[model samples]
Target: MRISVLCDVKPLLGEGPVWDVRAERLWFIDSLGRRIYRCTADGAEMRAWTVPHAIGSMALRDGGGAIVALQDGFHAIDFETGELTHLVDPEPDKPNNRLNDGKVDARGRFLCGSMDTGESDPTGALWRLDPDMSLHRLDDGIICSNGPCWSPDAATLYFADSFTGEISTYDYDIATGAVADRRTFAVLPKDRGGAPDGATVDAEGYVWSACVFDGRIHRFAPDGSVDRVIEMPVCKITSLNFGGPNLETLFVTSMAEPPLPKYPGDGPQRGATFRVEGLGVTGRPEPYFAG
Candidate 1:
């Protein structure tokens, strides 16, 4: 496969990568930078907007604008006016926790997880935001939340708590937006030197995860077997998504600042977005938040 940098702009903490199938564009967030960016399939016509607080993740809305998970809570962002309207805060009492990774399910519900800012406490939890704008807490006692994705049939949900270094799978009820029977799907060995960050599933049902300090992208089969591993040039690879005209390109994101001293050799493209092509597998279009 061919891997190359998609853009020159680097972000402090590049995390979420969302592909807008209908618009043929890619949207990503610079969490620490508090910036949201949009670009075409070719990485041109790039545009950015700065928010007031650090952003965890975001999803395009079905009606218009977008829904963002900021440090404070969920907000509706209007691309035309750049106005951020407060929606709801799932963890209002836990001021130390901030929303992290999020994705829209096939049934049009937005699911996101919160993470403890200190990265030490287990105050985080997984939450679901229905199309009606109501919220529900699915799971709790998480340290660091990341990588929320679903299987091809939408019957399984995979999520990772980076601090735990384990990816868990849950039986997902698409119709009711419920998750149960959580079990270990995969784990990053302690000797691996990194944790699983963000992930996405291909159309063939293979799950792709970005290893943070390990500098690798791992593909896991449906049965939770390691299918393959693709090493990256950057050390702090954060997240990835499938974009491009046919959803054949894997757009990867990374972080540049707060360099990890243990894993050296990070070049100038550390925080720049990268794309992998010719994987011989495409991805399904990500669903937009119906709310």
Candidate 2:
């Protein structure tokens, strides 16, 4: 409880922080600072874009622009001319692999993930982004496919495979995305450095996770227990969302390095960007022009 300071898009891998209820503001990225962040709602105006590669997630595309998932492929981020174009690179030939965490399905499609820049084992996979943009891989080796939410009547599908700390639950059928019943749903505690980064499911279905490096950001409870534990002073927090104007305010995204080699940014909660006020929860809206 009690978190503030939403205005630093240091973004050296800020992951994906969303809250774009019809352009109210807040769009994120920093994945290696390839850039992509547009704030407002206290954070004032920020706007950014430098992406050419290395951007692990993004959504919110229906008729405008946004549906990035690059690291190697899957693009379309024209916030209104900033353009990043090029939509179709799925594996391009597997130049090592990238494209992590993503969301935008309630039929709008655009669910993503594709790890393995040497994230230990399991090559990684999980995708879907049809609407002529074409690209459907859906589930694969998966070694680190962080959160991929979808469950506000989208049937039920909330994933995570950050090395497998468990956070599963699937049974969707949103017209065709199909994802039969799974299990676990929330297991955690694998020595504690935690992994399950980025996840969402509010409006009552609680299942908000971040946990990366154990800084804290949890709220599982749909039978999986533990219903709230937002701490995070910063240890590499990767993503989170639920913006202001009634969304209950809660938007975090940290990462000051620490992929292990160390010696890159030092740390101050890594790359900043946080906020957590009255987080009773309320976020579920953002899915546009699937075309």
lDDT of 1 by residue, 186-219 (tens): 9876666789999999999999999887889999
Q: In model 2, what lDDT does residue 250 have?
A: 76
Off by over 4 Å in 2: 1-15, 18-27, 30-35, 57-97, 102-140, 148-183, 186-206, 209-222, 225-247, 250-291
Q: After superposition, how far is residue 55 of candidate 1 from its true place, in Å?
A: 0.3
lDDT of every model, 2 decimals? 0.91, 0.78
Q: What's the CA error at residue 99 for candidate 2, in Å? A: 2.3
- For each candidate, what TM-score against the reference? 0.97, 0.31
- Candidate 1 stretches with Cα past 4 Å from truth are 259-265
- Tell me how candidate 1 scores on lDDT: 0.91
